[model samples]
Target chain A: MDIKSLKNYLYWLYCQFELITCSYLMEPWEKLLFYTFNITMLVMVLYTAYIFVPVHISTAFQFFLHLLGNQHENTVSVVK
Target chain B: MANPSAVCNGHLHHHHQKQNNLLKSGIYKKNGITKGMKKNGVSNGTLHKKTITEHFEQAPMYVAVLTFLGFGVGTIFGYLRDFMRAWGLEKRNVAAEREQQKDFVPLYQDFENFYTRNLYMRIRDNWNRPICSVPGPQFDLMERVTDDYNWTFRFTGRTIKNVINMGSYNYLGFAETDVNALKTVTIELQKYGTGICSTRQEMGSLDKHVELEKLVAKFLGVEDAMVFGMGFATNSMNIPALVGKGCLILSDELNHTSLVLGARLSGATIRIFKHNNMQSLEKLLRDAIIYGQPRSRRAWRKILILVEGIYSMEGSIVRLPEIVFLKKKYKAYLYLDEAHSIGAVGATGRGVVEYFGMSPDDVDVLMGTFTKSFGAAGGYIAGKKDLVDFLRTHSHSAVYATSMCPPVAEQIIRAMKCLMGLDGTTQGLQRVRQLGKNTRYFRRRLHEMGFIIYGNDDSPVVPLLLYMPGKIGAFARRMLEKNIGVVVVGFPATPITESRARFCVSAAHTREMLDTVLNALDELGDFLHLKYSRYSKSSHPELYEETRLELED
Candidate 1:
């Protein structure tokens, strides 16, 4: 639907592919190569998450502040 | 046109004309006018016309709309029915839960689990990938992918050439690229086309059939002979005709399955004698003659003793002289199946009787197959003229099955002629002698190697016993990797734990080629720890002596 959702869908597809291929890669050397491929995919996903983390944390903090303000107003009204 | 009554009259007139046209075309018919219409003092045609006009005027739009509604509802119903069917297929049927009860598998399902899933069968599948070349000294076999770590089999579909052939029943190597056999085959192919396309009883038999029968009878010194298309069926189909329910059949324990099956189909009481054990056979014969039959206490109409010239599995030669003595003593007929022994044994290659210096007449029914010795096809029942004639008329195999292909029969005839010294060459006799030499040389070498082998010393069929079921696959794999084709047998062909590889010696094999095989086997035996029977070398030296004595006789 959106760029972020599309990216998530692509990541999901890659994870499924990796899982299936991991089972198929049975030899020790093949597993070792697959392990390297898995680590690379993990690192790429981590880097993407790092780029979007600042915006995500700020938005989460603002939502928590608005909830606290509403709670305080409700408490004052009850006291009155 | 604007006046309502005038417009209505014009529409009525058009409808009346259309009705009249339909009546003239004979599309509509009326039986007889009703009494009420006749009594109305108006004619029947006028009354009928009035009734039709009245009916058409009433709700023509309603009828069309009703028809469309019916069609739409019917289509919707059809779609719903199809959707329900698909949905039912997606779910498991509760009614079939009875079949899912524990251990309630169908017979075929049990077979799949027991036989198809067996380890040896799996190994066999991997061992025998089809060969592209002739089944001779060297041929190509498709490689099987059984290695680990492959997600899927990436079939190379390429053939490996020049793999030493140690399988196939090409006893004298006649099936190989023999110039004489091939030339005969070419000529026969042109003369006979492919097959006769009819049963032997019909128009299938050609002059060549008569020629072959005569040659076989002459070669074996029998009065007459009859041939069947399939070697296996020759025994299974003909045996029943020879003996029936009132008869008794004493079969050797280790005879080929075809003989055992034939004896069973005869509906005779079957008694098994220990393989190549003359004493056991004599004891059985004595008891049968004395006791008559178990429950009936009546003497048997006839008693038939069945034995193979050479036991295919154990490679032991039948004690023909001793058996013949017992058959005569008991007044029982002897049926000797020489499917394996005919082509590979004796000085002249006439089979066991020739090897043992006995009369061919000693065997009442002399059954031998051309598949092994002639390296062609079909089998023959050779005996007295009356027996041959009787079988010709009554044998189900001859009557129902198509005769052997003319080319195959010709190949057999050519091979026979060569063996008989009629081809004006020493090549046939030389090949037979070479086969004897090769068989003895290979068996002796294997014995000297401390490898536990089965079979008589002179037998071309040398079975190297492994005794371990698990290692059969390993031995086969190792041999194939070394580019040698070998046949490995396990249960139920042999005992459960007595798995072994059967190596049939062909005359085409040179001394050097056999040594190459021995070298590979030695390495494999060492790697797999298969040299357990090293100490038990030549368990039956007396059996070897017996063969020598028979040869001397």
Candidate 2:
């Protein structure tokens, strides 16, 4: 193939790889596993938040983080 | 370094090795591959070996995904199970709280039922009939015939106007009208509001209240006075606040309910004397003086001798001179309740003490109520300034409750002013003497008519005895038909056997009204088949002769 055609072919292959990876990540099984890991990590983070930080500072930080994390997770799940 | 075909050939060799191993093993026997194996020449087939990673990659992707999915589902279920257990514990705690609340319901219900069903029922059933139920149809027939003449109907709008109001302690016509005094009350009401919202200790104390106290003290011949919301509170607060665990109260058996309630609350040992019996009072005083000795070095203090100035039910005046002598001899403090005698008895409406010409200081404490003479409400206790000061500070009823209404205090002040010569001393004293004369005339006339009169000869309260309970309602109805108003007294308030009709003679009544009332009573006696002949001196001889002949036979 000519040099331009070869460059076009390489770009097409990159797009195909992206599509395959996205479809696999968006599957119901993959989503369920992701959510379970996310919730477990959140529980551990909350427990650590109470122990390592002063109550007032931790409470304010926890509320902001929980709101941001919940919004991101909901939007991602809905789009999928 | 390797060719494509060589690498493909190496992968095929490995796959063939794995197939050979499967065929050589138990797969051939389990599958029963005798015909298929012979056709394919299974013995000559090569087998291939695969690596662990390569074998895992060959497995379905769903199997690996399902394993992680199962672990996630199991974790969520475990959390849900723990949450359900906590919810169950909370529900049990709520149920236990509800059970604890259920225990108090029956006790509250029982108290409500007792007042509603039992006490109120008895009051409703005996509304108009004398407190004592009359036997037979005689009372009913009299009531039916005398509907128009029923004075109780006119007064209370009740048909059963049978009760002889002997139970009422209103001995004087004070509860009745003194026209000039009432007119003054209307004038005072225009100036003062109806009630005082704050307690006596607060800003509610009015000038009229202070004036009433002064008037009451002067009327009773004392140095100072303090008012109470009720006669009951007057006795309950004054008695207990003065006497302590160290003191003894010598009370009369026939003392009013307020006195009894006060003595009980005083925390003092109570020594009761026989009704109107001076000997018994002396005996109690001696016993208390001896028994009240402290085991320690403390000497016994003086005792309090409590008595009513007038016995309400018996209508007997207290033997004031004798009581005063006993009180002085024993060195005991005397407390007298002149509830019935204030506006009705004595030479100048000064009650039992004035009747005997005794000084107010002779009695340590003098308590009286305005409900009787002033024709209003409230009570007062008169004593030395120190005792009044102590009571004003220490009495719980005074400290806690709303003060007496300003208008009621104003009315009492005006009434006392009228009694104490706002008009003139001559007119006031004249009215007082007229009341005494009327009481005597009414009592003598009733006694002469063969009516068994209860109470002392000087008392304005004339109780006509009807020995038979069955005749009580009939007698009251017949008297009402004659345009005469009288009250019937019966059981619970008095002994059923002593049922009678009580007539309260007022100073407002004229001689003509008295004469008319007597004539009507004579007619009532005839209508009821009651005998007036027994009262006649001329008919007595015949009655005696008839008894003598029966004895001879």
Candidate 3:
């Protein structure tokens, strides 16, 4: 909903992929690494939701509009 | 003070005090700010849980809607990114095509455009899908099973149960997995570990390599033999050592590409004669010996006549006796490439020399490979003891490249022993006989059906002419749909107009299998209008007249 929550979600997704990749690697401590990652992800998601939701929603709307406009311009030029 | 704002300020002050303690411990940095109040002053664990529960309950519908929107928008953006990449690639390809058209020959430009836009891309896109995995006789292939008019490709899982194999080079069926030669290989692998880890001149030569070389020399009836780690390199790398700038080479016009490379690499003056034409070969040899060379008029230090025991493309066996007579008459050393003929043609599989009743000693240098007939991997140079010793020291392949692995060498030795009847069994003799019989039978059957086939009747590599360009792909696909794996060659591999499907007969195939293939081919022949019988109107007067009358109407 908000910029902070979105940022937290993206970071969580990045960490999830990292955990998956680490699991694929031939590491002895992969299970331990995944356990630590799961605990940290829960704390981050809740903390960001509690403190930063309202302020970020407004800022996130502006950033989203800017991103859409930039991509539209890029697609037009590339097509030409 | 009894003010409403006073209560809010008091709660905020308490939260700020707790935040200060947490911030001092280096937490809540990426979350921007943690200046907020919870309903109660609880422990950190309880507080964290309370925050999560409160946030979710506060706006359940809002969270769900935003979550869905995030996923939807992310997917759309990802697809747009891929689309943009593809659009850029098309533009680049178009520009490249325009530049190529301007710079290249028209035929080459046309070929480039066709491959880039059509054939090559289709091959790359469907590379893994259409081609069967573990390619061999009776391989596992994907079959389209129709269920209630809706069709889907399904893996049969059972080695294409009854599929006829006309694709592999397993001529005597020696390459089949169930051969006893593999037992020796397994034992050799355990003894020698996997590879020798060095060139033959170094420490790569094991006792197996020496034993195999001796076995090859004994089998070919030569004084000595030297084996190479690779078949292609055996010819390509060894030619330079045998011939040099002062020498001249008379090669067959239709010799294999590896032979061509070896001749070119030698830097010798190369002359190509009409394929298997004894008169053309004699003329080239006589001219080289009498006139010396065209430009320099310098006497050629030596003359080498290069020919294959069997021409792979045309499936024609070489006129070895005539060629040998010319080689003797002109004083040119003969180089016979027996890559396909070895373990295939003769009664005991001694190759074309034996097939023609000529002695192996008559040829100066015999070049053959174990890849085809021996069901192993490697090649050899069999000749006089002095020549073999010379090549061992001078040949780049022997000196620089790693020697053949022990297991492969052992397998080749076993195959040769079996062929020589040293294994005390007639299985190898039986396979050789069966292959010869199958080849003639299949070729005769094709002739009887009125389909045009190329190559000697006894040659296993038979190419049935498709002639039409579009039919190359169509014929192959149709045959595959009928569960036959066939090798088709077009354009660059063969003459542009002479596209054909090459069928190799293996000893593994039975008479019944060959009969089934003939039946399937007859149906395909009529459907594709490929049969000469269809074209021969006199033979089928009624059908021809009906077609002619229909055309007139």
TM for every model, in the order presented, reads: 0.68, 0.58, 0.65
Candidate 2 docking category? incorrect
Model 1 stretches with alpha carbons more than 4 Å out: A1-80, B1-105, B109-116, B126-128, B146-155, B534-553
For B1-553, candidate 2 gives per-residue lDDT tens digits of 1221132231222222223333353543454433443344532232211111100011234423433343344334334433554477322211122446775654433433332232222222223434223221112212332232221233233354332232234433344344664675666677776777777787767887787777676666556788876777888777888787877788888788889989999888787998778899988777666666546534456588889877666667777667777888878899999887776766667677666544566688888887775656778888777778887888765787677777678667765655555543444455566667767777666656666566677766666654333244456545655545456665445553455566666565666666777787776654443332234544323343453364355
Q: Is candidate 1 or candidate 2 better by DockQ?
A: 1
Ranking by lDDT: 1, 3, 2
Error of 3 at B534 (Å): 9.6
Residue pairs in steric clash, candidate 1?
none
Give the candidate number with the greatest lDDT.
Answer: 1
DockQ of each: 0.02, 0.00, 0.01
Supply candidate 2's per-residue lDDT for B463: 66
lDDT of 1 by residue, B19-86 (tens): 33223424212422233224544334331221210000122343334334433332333344335544
Q: Estimate the lDDT of model 1.
A: 0.71
Candidate 2: segments with Cα more than 4 A from true spot: A1-80, B1-183, B293-302, B523-553
- The C-alpha lDDT values of all candidates are 0.71, 0.59, 0.69
Docking class of 3: incorrect
